[model samples]
Target chain A: MLEEVVSGGGSLIIIDDINCCGRSLLKCFLAAAAHKGDSIHILNFDIPKDELRAGMDSEVAERLVFHDGFMDPLNWNGEAVLPASPFTLKELRVCIGADASPVTLVLDSLSWILLHNPVSAVCHTFQHFQRQAKSTGLNVRQIIGLLHGDLHKPAVVDSVCCLASTVVTVTQAPSSEAQGTAVVLQRRKSRKIVRATEYFTILEHFALKSLGQHQPLMKLAGEKEETPAAETDPAANLTFNLRLSEEERRAKERVLLPYHLSAEVKSSLLQSHAGVAKIYYEPDAADDVDEEDPDDDLDV
Target chain B: MFAAGGSMASSSFRRKVGGGLAVIPGTRASVHNGQLLVSTGASSLDSVIGGGLAVGTLLLIEEDKYNMYSNLLLKYFIAEGVVSGHDLFVASAEEDPSSILQELPAPLLDDFHKNNLDKEEKTTGDLQKSMKIAWRYQNLPKLEVTPAARSRFGHHYDLSKAMSSEMLQAVRCHTFFLPTECGSAICCSMGHAYTLLLQSIHRVIQQEGFDGSCPQKKHKNILRIVLQSLGSVLWGDDICCSDHPQYIHSLTRFLHALRGLLRMSLSACVISLPAHLIQNKAILSRVRNLSDTVVGLESFIGSARETNALYKDYHGLFHVYQCPRLNSLLCDVSGTKDLAFKLQRKQFTIEIVIHVELQGVLRNCLHLPPDLSDRASRSSKQDLSECSKVLNAGCAAMTAGRTHLDF
Candidate 1:
């Protein structure tokens, strides 16, 4: 997913399932941005700032700037929660400050912001940030937003998906641990639409490492019947040896016709036989002899 | 044919521009920048689609049962760009495109380095010489020549060595992550997503100055746009319950507009949709109409017939459901019929199967000197007398090799 984001210049990415998707996606983006020597700013609206900071790998830690709004929600005299209105959003943007180099903005959770403000208001503010991020002169390369799908209505989710350039959804595994979590990453850029799925394991610090491949599990029962154990048994397997027995070999070597005769017959057949063609039928000599000798036979 | 195109390009006197669109040399209708064609990355795929996908065309790859095989092709497409230094615009809805690109298997050539050191120790090294047959096959008599008017983009890829770090570094990628959260401002509407994607791509193309007008720009680049997962339920569509038709309609509109956008710029697009997930033929056909090439892959996972002995030799069936008429002119349609795809450890081959009767083939070839070539040995025949029998036997053996089920 980070590759998709990095390939597309100045994109706004939304990861819908925060917990299921894991913070590793965030770390991945940060690592990529760092690889490109781009500055990184992550708004912490879900996890505590200290833990998020502690989990950061050294590779991308120095490049990252965390906005600890979740730990310390903006409040007016400790009484009212500051809504994620344009005013607060503006304040957040200003607090991050401007850099000459490109920066990647990571919004930890859009659901947290949507909780405080209505969908339309939040969307409008989002458009503002996205435009700023995508602006030609701005150092903002891309903006990544994380949201929880279950918390909002389908229409609202649809709107959010539409607003972003790429959408990745993480479906959590059930508590039984029998199945790994499924992550579907989709990108719609111009006419090209691509989707990929991976099963991932949750590690320490909300990290996700994908399982090697995403092949569907085979149904054992169905496969068992197709190649039953009894049929596959070693005793049941047949082996054929083409080696001929001594008697058969002798029989094959025995000439049915002499080589000279065979050659003469072959040559003769090749040359047309013009004289033997006139007789369509002839009376058998035995039939004529029987008719002539009927009176002399011992018929009495 | 390429020499002719080169000559035409050099003369410039015969150059024709069709309504501001660069008329690709020697082609009647394939209008694009400089007549350059891009590889679909997999040679098997390239052959299936006639020539490599023509510039400015869209390829729709629909997945069957599971997305494993189709996604592999997608990986090939992206990895090809990385290797060829094409600018990539990847908008992924599921996994980070970066991670996918990172995990892509290095092309077979990467192993050439490792194998080179031990070359002297192996007696089987000579086999590599025979392996170049596919590469040499191009020099064969033009059995089914795609006409000169049809620009051939026959850049065959050795999938094994196609991906490398140097090529990846050369690639300029514009990657956007679409938000999937319900009710998030970013995930608001399908139309907005399509619009935002188009705008981003337009910005990418214009920035590169490869929008076909800037011939002065020494670096000619093909903008490759890849979108992953068109109709996954996570794309904010309740595809199962209701609103399915609305989602399909929106997707069609997006693709239609995208196809229109490809014309002005030197670009091509590849999109993969999970047909099993969509579960609607009408919508898929509608999707099909928007693409120039349509390739569908069906693996043996769900069907009971997959277990049959006949299919045991095949990994899957690849249907060239549609090919651009331009490509059809280049390749024999019969050559692509009854195509089965078999994936080896390093590569995949798409070929027609000819099933010969198991009996008599070995005996005939071994006993007789084999067909007309045996005329030299026929003079020394042990039997000169049995002319008719010898003639009949010789005739029977001569016709033996011709019998087979071609389909």
Candidate 2:
């Protein structure tokens, strides 16, 4: 999603939960965004106040917009047991809409809000935000929801998927095993059209990075080729005209050379049968002897 | 001398018979004073003090379950000194001397009785048997045992006479019970008592020198100087938190004096501080700074928090390498290893993986948005969520492949 947005020539990026690997993500995003003259805006929920200022470079910090208060959900009145804040939904929509630049808006998590608020409210608010972003022609909008084995709760998740153009599921694989994590990206409610699964490994922290670049995207070996019926075979349609590039035709000929046949003269075969006359004369003598023997046996 | 040599040979024989090896004293040797021998009960503690506490050093034994063990060791030291004609002065800050004397193990009591019997040969079997019977009955009331024995012992036993006899001969032993609540106010009084004891000891040493020969007149003068407990007068309704600072300062100064001016050989000072007092960061910080050795006794109430904070502070100071439950910050051992094990064992309800890098990033980001200061201008929920998402993604990506990306 990030790559798609950057490739699409999007500029400013507002990404949340970047703190987790935000610094590294910012580095990568900046590297990519720098090419397109795009500025990255990172908002981290978890970074301590003092360090947020001291640790980040002044240049990056200028573009960075952080919201630290989100750490204490009580500040959002999330502790009220019900979603009471009238401004919450509006604020969410406004935040989604505020990116005037060609930007990708990344929401790090929807899990906290879903857990705190009614599922319907979260879904309604998220859907509204999604529609607003879509209408605004925002270059790219990426919302990463951390689903910690709670994808089974389909109410909010289903709503999220419905509103999202693309749903990427990032999971951590068991470290002791040979297999690493598989990041599956599927278009919303359309499994057939677009389903891409990429393998990723978790390194030192919970930062997920791609596997080796050299690994093949597809593996197809030990497959049996289906034999074509004679009438349906392309090779059988010799009379049909087909256009091919010179390079392609040369490649085709190289593939088809092994099945050609050779024809010898029929006269050679007729000359080989001339020494069989004695066998033909013995057949008439055997017939006369059989008739005489049968008459003599009958008289006795 | 005879007893010391016999014990030494017996110990050597036991070691040889047990392990079939000649024991080598590694980096330590025992010191002897004429016919007297003193050994610290624990080798680890003994190694630090260069042959244990000096003979005349005033030992403060805090009352607790461990007090019994410490007192028994003190008794052994006293017995050694007494036999060598060096006087032992015991000042109990808490327990009753009679009760403690009664609770003394039979072997120890028997040794005292034997010493008494050896001095006063005229005391026959009947009197000896009566004295034994009386000693048995003395602590029965204090003990959760028979009530009849308490009265019987109370009637027959002369505790003062017994104590005097124990302190008889060239070795004069004095025992005083000074019980004070281990609080800030009491700490001040204890500090004063400690100072006075040091000053007197200093005076005695100056006049008589460290040599084992102090004249009887000087010894009498020393014994006449009484150390009184101001606990009862200090315990009044007027006590206030305002007095705490003065007490803390005085206590710190007193400890400094003991450590510096007195220059007395201290084997150990078991300080029994009230849990609440130690929990006060100001008081504890001062105490920690002033004292090298602190034996903190925490009661059941607020024990967990107090113990944890104490361990943390002490661990920070590099005083303790390991505590039973608390992690030693000074040690290079990974605390995460313990956490991971606990997580694997299902010891806690929640497993929290603190992403330090993310935390650092969040700290950097928190200062943004002047609205964050004005609660009304707080960033929208969408903004916060986006921030959370970017942080998670970045963290995941970085952990996965050391990838650096701007969010």
Please, what is the TM-score per model?
0.46, 0.24
Which candidate has the highest lDDT of all?
Answer: 1
lDDT of 2 at B334: 20
DockQ of all candidate complexes? 0.01, 0.00
Residue-pair clashes per candidate: 77, 53
Which residue ranges in model 2 land beyond 4 Å of their true spot?
A: A1-300, B1-86, B92-170, B174-195, B211-243, B261-279, B288-292, B296-407
- Residue lDDT tens for model 2, A1-300: 334422432122222231222333334344344334334433233344454445344554455444433455465544432123322435544443465554433333345554554443444344344334455565433333333235234332433453344444433334443123333333322112233344444333223355432222232222334353355565655876577889998898777333222213222432446566643344552243545345332211
TM-score of chain A of each: 0.58, 0.45
Across residues B245-287, which tens digit of lDDT does each residue of candidate 1 receive? 4555766777888888786778888888765555456777888
Interface RMSD of each: 26.8, 50.0
Highest TM-score model number: 1
